[model samples]
Target: MSSAAPLLLSPKEVNLLKQSPTPISILDATWFMPNVARNATDEFLSKRIPGAQFLDLDDVASPHELGLKHMMPDQKKFSQACERLGVTPSSHVVLYDTHSVFSSPRALFMFRSFGHQNSSVINGGLPRWVHEGLPIERNSPSMIPSSHYEPPHFDARLIRDYQQIVENSKLDPQTNPDAEIVLDARAHGRYLGAVPEPRPELSSGHIPNSFSLPFNLFLQKQGTPDGEYTTFLPEQELRAALDNVVGAQYAEKIISGERPVVTSCGSGMTAGVLWLGLSLLGAKNIGLYDESWTGYAMRPSSKIVKTA
Candidate 1:
């Protein structure tokens, strides 16, 4: 297999890494949270999978936009970033991260947003990779200078902003042209207004007419190092969790032929995973609430936050 070959795999498929399959491009796409002190590129250069290369999230994003940290970059910057990483349009991207605990889903989003369908993250990320006893490399390859990686047309409508969420509420289904759905990715307590928020500045609780689907609940229970904080249920478990997560309120919206979804998280971070899961399951038209809870929560006039 060439480095451009596809590398999507499940835990069952992880054994192939031990054999050092050719043609597959594996990316050590590890990223740290904003609060975490370590730098990803420095860590990537220190050690990674045998043929694995570094895919910097910051580099992949729009450098021009200073307002939002890690918001998806525009197409020109996205194309250039991929090209710099030797990612041709034909490249099969497999992302691995230290925070399988978090960033893997974001990587999946970046790939899809760029219209590269042949990309998936390694389950449990690098920690799981090491757990499987796969080959590790310390030497950084001589930098492969970048080349052409053309991008598909920028799909502006594919993403939605805070104002869209407000507009969505006022849409009358019968008179409305196209309907939209909003998914709340906060914990159930926050969604239901039972618990206070992690971000103290924002008001607690979910947006109006939003479906509550806690992102952490999807984590595989066994894989998470911090059991209480994040849990990624396996495939079957995820489906089951989705049933519980996408409860009566949202299900009614979906069944009524309303639009599919636009996921919302505390500060627009974890909802990327919600969108990714929905996308993987064939939900064709979905977006993220870019301002998310922060947008609504911070606003005193917003009608949706229920204290009870």
Candidate 2:
């Protein structure tokens, strides 16, 4: 297995690393849907993993010039944010959240997008660590002075704007046969228009010809109260789940970078979870639709598909 295949670390692995001489930057990237009332920053201030800093997704994102939420910022902005968070180019970042795998993958995506490749998402997040009796600290760690961190030119290979997605959807698969595969990470009900979207004025459905692969399917319950801590499914199960949507043959090709894969969701957050899953499987030609359904559904001219 490639060193990266284990993309996740067990609570024990994290505990053991805490005692090691090597330095690792741990981030609490906890976030919640707008409908969810909890404030992640306040929660982090109350309790968090020792030596962990909070990475506020909403705070570090693009300034929403296009009216989209949490879009990736420019290279300079991202570099400045990393420096503020004490993330050096050599920092080995490990992200975790209160709600299992939900928002950590988005943080991982941000790190990778900003040319920070040495990063991973903690498998089951803070809830799991607490369940396992790992050490927790209430006091916030003092911020290390801003380090000179520089990122390479911003990479657009893993990103897709609304225009690209609109154009790709219009392509005839037979003529433009290699068009990117569009995958939506929303729930089946929302993807099928059977359930109302949490965001007002947005239609409930998916992009035309897009595959519905709910982000939750990639996770398995960790037996926590209220099922708070979920973990990524085993490799075998993950492969099977992915195969169901993209086909086993195509899934292999996608993982090997022979085919293009694009992931999206409500506001581009859970889409990152899908991106992370594909990355763990060694996929290189992956792209994230940053505007996602929030932009797509609101557009009067965009095509939508509600049926499987």
Quick one: best lDDT, which candidate? 2
lDDT for model 2: 0.83
Candidate 1 wrongly placed segments (more than 4 Å): 1-8, 11-23, 63-66, 170-179, 189-200, 223-234, 248-258, 295-304
Q: After superposition, how far is residue 187 of candidate 2 from its true place, in Å?
A: 0.5
What is the lDDT of every predicted structure here? 0.65, 0.83
Candidate 1 residues 19-111, lDDT tens each? 554334567766665556899888888877766778776666654222445667787888887777777776667777766656667767767
Clashes of each: 11, 0
Residue 153, model 2, lDDT: 67
Residue-by-residue lDDT tens digits, candidate 2, 205-295: 8787678899988888868654567988887788888999878877888888877989999999999999988877778899999989998
All candidates' TM-scores? 0.78, 0.93
Query: Model 2: residues >4 Å from true position, as ranges?
Result: 1-6, 172-176, 225-228
